[model samples]
Target: MKNIIKRNPNTMPKPVGEYSHVTVIPRNSELYTFSGQIGNDLEGNIPVSHKEQVENTFKNIERALLSENLRAEHIVKVNIWSVEEINWDHFDNVWHSFFETNPSMTIAYISALGLPEIGIEIEILAAKPSE
Candidate 1:
């Protein structure tokens, strides 16, 4: 079952893109926050295309969560920052393909990043029921 309730109230303007206006996480859940994940692959090579960068970044996030025994389903929130202009089509394509549940996401087009090779960075907030 989903531990968060994501919604866009009718009274408020619909989100400009694929995201909810509000996200509500249940009480007593264990929250895990990850640092910004970049698109660097195992060989430390980052692809030049924003699409590839976005794809690899999500893959890295999966690998990171798995290291802690968590899967994509455990993620409650998604946040992304891009050095280039936001490409909704390509971004949503990769994002929807990766995550079955549309967790609330915050994405922005930023002017710069930590590394010149890194075109995109993503951070995620995951949760699990407290034992």
Candidate 2:
């Protein structure tokens, strides 16, 4: 965790969201890239409420990281896209539930997503030393 530095540089504008201005990854680290994960269940049913959707998405991300033997703390960056507006508090809660350290994040409200029923989708990058 010490190898990954979260920077809020004095020269750059202060972050308006719950994230660092930049994330610095050290050399020789093995990076894991995850595709955007939605809130759909195995049955193809999506959560109805925004909060539920966000929660499910978080679970999906956690499962993906687990497959690679990585936890949220190893994540260096994250990008969240939503079809509608989201409550910052809820987002913060989800982040806290997953990550011990806050990784660099970018959240965007968009007109549409990959799925019509999905309210939120998340993608992340994680790193570990190459063995």
Q: Evaluated with TM-score, which candidate comes out highest?
A: 2
> What number of clashing residue pairs does each candidate have, in the order they appear?
0, 0
The lowest-lDDT stretch of 10 consecutive residues in candidate 1 is 1-10
Worst window of 10 by summed lDDT in candidate 2:
1-10
TM-score of each: 0.87, 0.89
| Cα lDDT over the full model 2 | 0.84
Runs in model 1 with CA error above 4 Å?
none
Q: What is the Cα-based TM-score of model 2?
A: 0.89
Judged by lDDT against the true structure, how good is candidate 1? 0.83
Tens-digit per-residue lDDT, 6-116, candidate 2? 779899998887678778887788889999989877677898898888888888888899999988877889999998888879878887777776789888889998767
Q: Where in model 2 is the C-alpha error above 4 Å? A: none
